[model samples]
Target: MREILTLQIGGYANFVGSHFWNFQDEILGLREAGFEDPMIPTHGLNMDVLYRQGETRERQATYTPRLLSIDLRGSSGAVNPSGSLYERPPPAVVSSIHTWQGPAATFKAERHERNKFLQSLDDEEAQYREQPGDAKAEEIVDVEVNERQRYIYQSLEEEVQFSTDYLKAHLHPSSTYQIPGCWQGVTPFEDYGTGQGLFSSSARSEEIRDRVRLFVEECDTIQGFQCFVDDSGGFSAVAADLLEDVGEEYGRTPIFLFTVRPPRKVYDTLASKKKKITHALHDSVSLARLSSIAHLTVPLGLSQVAACSVAEHLAILDEKDYHTSALYAAAINCITLPFRMEAVGPSDGSQSSGLGGTDMGTALPLVSCSDSRRVAMMQASFPSPALLESKGEIFYNLHNTSSLTPSTERPKLGDRVAKLLVLQGTQLPGTTGERATVGQVHKSVVKAHEITAKTGRFSSRLATSSHLAISECPLAVPLPFPFIFGNKIGRFGNILSRTVGGGKQGRGGLDVSSVPVGASVSSSEAVLPYIKRRALDLQRFALSRSTTGPSLLQDWGFDGEESKDLRERLTNMVAAYSEMVESSSSDTD
Candidate 1:
């Protein structure tokens, strides 16, 4: 069984990656038929832990990855690039403060005070009153010796030894924490950059390259790779490029990218225009390059998933949308359902899925492919029904295995059929045989897609229906599996009475096309809105003399020509889908 290697670049990506691993099929172990012998035993690569503190010198070499270069035990891979990087500590300058600093100084001071007290006691020779200030010095010293010597020894309470932990606390405590996880149980761990990120400058540096070489060599059994690039376009783009190079050198490995961006609206409303422009340029440039390298790249951003405009309480939510990483993590667990599931078959038995005919040496090739037509597919995913304020048929429409959502003007599903995998969460309420069973979820799936001439937007919203072949990818893909915790219950407020579509008075299923997992539009179709917006923005920026005509793209290592090429291909690709739909209808007529 070919295993897919996963890599997380930058901060948010690492956060998502951590949760993804913590919530998968192998949280216990992998047990598929052909996948019996896992391909990527080492699992994956993580870049955020690069310059970790003492990880190298202190900790035992047990796990390949631990978190944050903040690690009390992360490797010291930082290089002294310039002045005073480590010129030397300037010979321990002993100054005024050093004399009275610390326990030793306190001890010396105490001893000195004690000695002065003793001297005072001794100096109290017979302080001869009156004029006797002249009693010979030898006689005074003789009297003092005789007086104090007569008073003998002193005693006090017995001393008690303190606890070992206390001694350790004051002395030295263990600095390294035993973090969980390993690359297939243990080997050479890599550090990719400074604590902030692997900046563009460091992407191709010798240190990072060496680490990549080592990572690939060890992943001899890997068949495919999944990468996470969250918001850090410069560094992540470079890293993604390096992986692409590696894939080309050894095998034409299919690389899937999950590029997460925060809500653009959030930025537009909250950030400076220059910052927004900077983000836009970085995002567009990175998307262009990363798209070229990966077989498929999915965009994840807050606003992309349109919350319903229905009653105030009717919005689609996944438990909590507080953290982007958590939401993306939940989505990852949902999207990767096919690999984790028992081989497709009758619900009665535990037979192995016999589709050994591997594509590109990988098992589930359709989910991720090297097809140029399939690249840049729009992605959407609904973690569970709990995300909805109201449950029932409308709740069913918000989930998709392909993560496809409707485009602004229409749903993005293309002429190709879609494959849906419905992963059930434990929160799914049902009695004994009724709760979240395959049959239950299957019914929910069918109910969500049921078409009635009089039903909610099913008639007019079918914009490109005739030419587009909805079932040919073959048909919509859905998978219903055992319950998962990521789909929590009671997180979204108690059920409310509401309409499926937007208006408060309306009562019907959601304009299913508009919900989060609303529809199965082709990724190409789904990306049009964002792409068109980007193209227009870039054109102005790339054309303006003050902006240096495409220098931003150049700075980020994205070629101006390549940007135009990809954008053009996508524009044409979406158009072709429309043309195909139109032609099919004409032939039928």
Candidate 2:
């Protein structure tokens, strides 16, 4: 078994990770419930790849994700830090106060109460424990449990108070670590340097390192690390430091990093302008540093997701982390699906090794283009158009769900590109809603390739390679998922002819069980603009002497020498993309 250790870095990263884990938990639940789908007979998924099984001190079996999450104090909301699987020992009694020799003041705060959904989960667990051997009793207790959970999920507010509110997976006791002396609203952890010196203390750094080493020690064959970081804030620095330590300890282990951010609202004010400048500088430095340590880095999140083409058919709130994180979680889940697949046979020279088997080591190079371009962009089509319409026509449109490109213009010819496309749960065209077999899916992909070739979708001066991976199993939407779908979506994530309204309007009333999704991670000239924009912002603000750049740099602990180094690093990154484009164009001419 090749194990991949997962890490979630900040509040928003945890928000995205929470949804990702919930999807995994839902799949596990379905398997345990004996749920079968004829359309997807062979899932080919090995859950052990991402999970670990062990026994607690009391000899109770426990199954949990091999994950490590770091966040600010009080960010976990009502979830216990040690989780609920293991029993907690009672606090030691203090019989005497010999140090102070005086009355000590005591202040107690109100405890957090569980939400309705969590309460229901507790009740179900209690009932299950009461009758562990009684199947009839279990059935009776769970008769209307799903319906109740769905209703509660639907009634949730648009804003997510905390990531733990929707988390479904049970984490190990050491999986979560909250930074001391840091609170979300009270502490100002908003810049690239705010997290500096946080782990300088030997005790803190050693503790975190020990937690990671514990998980790594258990793996027989370690594949790599999968990291999700919130790059919009100080967590970028935190993640970079952690990864550097890990890289030093574990030589040459590939780290696939997904840097994410929630949508931010733009304001027209002097303060906002200064803030934006600082943020731009932070972003440039964060990307440069993070990408250096990571084998492959994928930038995620849009400034305004509601304005993106992917949200055209759906209703989403731009300010809600709950809504935005769900979209990111879906894409992340689908893109990483190839990592857990079972190896069917020998390699077939495909990018993903013929869909029979693939790992982070094999998959990272495909999108990174042999390390010449380590940074890539992600685009996905959630609820992809793979089903037959009511008029018997099949639409294979894959929309741009990512913020990598704001426009829909075609790329210039002679631009080199490498793309990896992952399509899941697609049905064959002309079928009566029957899921496509593996062979049929391959045929559909071939047709897609032919169409793209005719339309010049991937025309380039140099060679361009596109790899396709197909999976019959669709992404299952758990009850805790945010209500982001529109009224036109059907139960199975297909589009309907008319809008149906029976539940609350604009509240995602449609009962979407699962969705066919298409996602691609690519390294090409198209992502040049994204890189150049940040580089330009950094140059205009940080490298200029006429502005407040120098003072801001000093405030972030970047001395003159350090600032120069960062600028050079970012400039080189942008130059690499430009050189690729120029080289391709020159060859074509």
Say which candidate scores most in lDDT: 2
Per-residue lDDT for 43-155 in model 2, tens only? Answer: 57888888999888899998899999999887877888779888754754867757776786543435567777677678878967784667786598675865776677765
Worst 10 residues of 1 by lDDT: 162-171
C-alpha TM-scores of all predictions:
0.52, 0.89
Candidate 1 deviant stretches above 4 angstroms:
24-26, 29-206, 213-220, 264-266, 269-277, 304-322, 342-372, 375-383, 386-420, 426-434, 443-488, 491-524, 557-589
Instruction: Give the number of colliding residue pairs in candidate 1.
Output: 28
* Whole-structure CA lDDT of model 1: 0.36
Clashing pairs in 2: 414-461
TM-score top scorer: 2
Candidate 1 local lDDT, 496-533, one digit each (tens): 23322233221111111011211222332344555555
Q: For each candidate in the order shown, give its overall lDDT on alpha carbons.
A: 0.36, 0.75
For the record, the alpha-carbon RMSD of candidate 1 to the native fold, in angstroms, is: 21.9
